[model samples]
Target: MTPTSLNTGVNEKKRSEWLQEVSAHLVESYEVTESGKNPIKRVFFEEQEAPLSILSHVWDEYDTYAEATLHWLYELAEGQNFEVRLKVAETVGQLATYEFLPVLRKILSPWAKSGKPSVQRLAALALAVVAYNEQEHIAQQALNLVDHWSNLKTSSSLQWTAIAAYGGYIGLLVPEKALDNLKIIAQSGNGKLFSDIAKAVEKLFNAGVQIPKLHGLVLNTLREWVDQGENTSVYRLSLLIFRGLMRKSWIVKNDIRQPTLLWLAKESKDFEDPIVYLMRNGLNLGSRRDSILAEILNWLEFVDRHPTLYKTLARIIFTLAASSGNERKRMCYYLKIWSINSQTAIQILNLINKHL
Candidate 1:
């Protein structure tokens, strides 16, 4: 026999033996129970390692074992336990290799149709992971599947999950295309769909995934929607997204923040509902409170004219001040300082004190 063929045969035998040993160890170590406890949770709740850890170690140490581990995970995903299935979906997603795409597709297709939001969301995320593969054909296939899921007319729940998954992964691959898709989705004027888009954007930022021009693209799109005044749902949804972006100071650039505040000021004139909603929900700005307050103060010239919005902003500042002693002191100092130079700030300080 050729030396190369001889070596291949020996390696194949070793791989088979190693896989067999790992499989046996997994079966013996982790017991899937009727209690529906996720195998992954065993590591935390029972303080014992589970088969997932062993499979991860195998996949990491031995490249050839990746395929075997995926197949094993696919089987585990079919089990009756909901948490186990969700965890398996997550683990498969983290694998994020082209080789896992076919198996994951098989596992996720049924899940996409399962009519369970949690299952569908997990499936969406797992299926989207294939977009991370470097192979052109594989990534295209993943994108195609997401497009199909998002376009499913009969199921809005499925569409929501697909939008979220698309939001999470597509920007990493094609920022312009992602923005275009989001804009088209927004045009549907479905309020729930708009919420999913906002959530997807929040998920993208929360995960700290950097995509060039994506933030600007999203901001511009929302600005255009608010500017058009064609759809009240879109206008309201845009404000919701603006609030989410503003809460994260690092994500809110000066250019974006200025336009957003302007939109809020303009919308506040006619739409107290969305404006009040933004104020009540958007106050968790953490350290960005100072900059955001300063920006709003800059608009005191305009906001001072709108009584409803003025009162809402004052209440939001009061809510921030009441959150803690440090914040109260900070707000007190800012209110005192700004109150000297601005009538609006003085009014806000008076309003806040009335509440305290």
Candidate 2:
């Protein structure tokens, strides 16, 4: 047999064994009905797995031993049993309360320090569940864990696990200090982790927990990631976060807006060549160019003092103009708005006229 087929066979056999083992444990944990219509066997059928809703129903009916079940689920969450553990994590989140806070912490704390990336991620995901469920007190602990994982220096994957957990669980709280660490990680040259961090930033939006001054932090982090050449995904994801914040008008203060524009302009000095390359070569920029121009216009209105970014801004605008459709027209409108009022805008207009 081929090696691929052999490995598949082995994996299937192992999965079968694991299912049998778990099913038997579940059945044994509860008394069997005379007709053998027990909830455990019913929910966890022979290769006819039920959805999370059904599993939750089963747990509700047999909740007399919830504490035992919670412990059982925690054990399952510690392994590579993704199907079992995902359900277990959900169940644990459902079962978790203020009383079990310490228990959950004890279960999650050790995994934060050492384990396979999957296990660590799930463990942190469980914590994220707790965080999402309104346990903001644990925010400090999770923030500490993020810091701890980041300082390990030997394991970028672990750092990502922590960041992912924070994104999933506590990034809404995105404590100012944690943002500092996240910015550092964005610039650490770990492409995969930065991608995951981008995803985490995406999750932060989903979590809908508002951080104070989150826009400034996100913009600053985006600039640092772009400057460090972390990866395009990081920039793209960060841009999504920025756009979302802007659309919501969350970062409304003129002070916040002006300084951020200046920061982007200042940071542009460090990445002229790379930005040029992206302008010329970026495949994804077409879809994203409109939003990019909108941001540039917003910055141009406030960025007259930062002359250094004028040339860089001009390069970005013209390159985007090279794209087709209304995006080109939108860039032209912003170019006109800037050219009439500001030197930097006039400079951007001149550069675009000369180049494209």
Candidate 3:
């Protein structure tokens, strides 16, 4: 069975006529709904693609027809076909602007409540697209959904869908509350959720919105991740925020202190975040790991003073100097420390220097 009826089972002429009807309404479509048309099925699924043509065609007619068609747009979700559903979602996503954000939000409510994971996911995806479209929704609807979606769970494919969706949420909405939620999720090290959240935040920071408030939110969120329980890879995100923050001169060493300390502990021998697969060994750890020097210094100090953790500290430092980008800063810095304590540092230094 087909998931959705893209063709409306109508002849090409009928479909073409329907498309023309919608195209003529233009801005007047919203007025139609206000005039009490209340069309339950708002979307014209079969007539996707050349969307502007259809929209323009209806634009001159009764705007009511277009405005009332939103539910029909959402009904595309009812169709079990992935292609149809996604296309419908994409179409609605296109319509997700300030004028229609509330309608989009209403359209998505079904997925929020429905047990069908794909439907819910498509809803999220639609919102992501909406967020990306600058002329569309200002992001409030998407922002609201991100928080709503964070606490919800689904299948592996859904998780994959979520990975980028949540990222888009942060990137587009830039809502402080939603960003805060992401921060907490990242900090919790909810092993399952962090990777997705961290990855998303990284993408958002790179997407380039010159909102200082958003920038500060991103930095603080990273700091929250560090304090909560960040893994090494997560530090990649932390560093991104850190680097960005550094340029703004908004975040200082005080900001780096706690998160950097947590990152150090992750590199420490006993308590590493579950995702540190890089320790498996490869080439060198040269310029690539420049930011890590600050972390290595913290680890060294923690271990040196603790004495009990000296062995774990030694292993981490040794690992650092041997990794792909450890040549100048990381290895050299460690070598300096070893030079001071030739007795124990010599052996580990020699092995690490091999990589450098």
Find the candidate with the highest lDDT and give its number.
1
Clashes of each: 0, 1, 44
Q: Estimate each model's TM-score.
A: 0.51, 0.42, 0.41
Winner on TM-score (1 vs 3): 1
**lDDT score, residue 218, model 2?**
49
Model 2 Cα lDDT, one tens digit per residue, 1-356:
99999888777756447656545223323323446534443235544444444555655687675566555655665432356667656555444433345445545554555556666777666655555655556444445556777665577766776676656545665545555666567656676675566566655533332543443454455555454443554555555545543333322243443333334334554434333334332234556556655555665765576454455566556666666655466556667776777666776666656665
**Model 1 agreement with the true structure over 1-356: per-residue lDDT tens digits:** 99999888877756446655545322212445577634432333222344556655676689887667656665664444576565677666656453555555556666666666666667766766667666777667667777766666566666766676666556556555655566566666565677678776655544442553454455556665566553455655566676665544232343333334334323344333334334432333343345456555665544555443465566556666676776677777777887776777888788767776
> Cα deviation in Å at residue 153, candidate 1?
2.8
Where does the lowest 10-residue lDDT sum fall in candidate 3?
274-283
The C-alpha stretches of model 3 lying farther than 4 A from their native spots are: 1-49, 56-68, 78-83, 135-141, 144-164, 169-179, 185-224, 229-349, 352-356
Kindly indicate the candidate among 1 and 2 with the higher lDDT: 1
Decreasing lDDT order of the candidates = 1, 2, 3
> What lDDT is reached at residue 60 by model 1?
69
Report residue 171 deviation for candidate 2 (angstroms): 1.1
The superposed Cα distance between candidate 1 and the true structure at residue 302, in angstroms, equals 20
Quote the positional error of residue 135 for candidate 3 in Å: 4.8
Error of 3 at 45 (Å): 12
Error of 1 at 320 (Å): 22
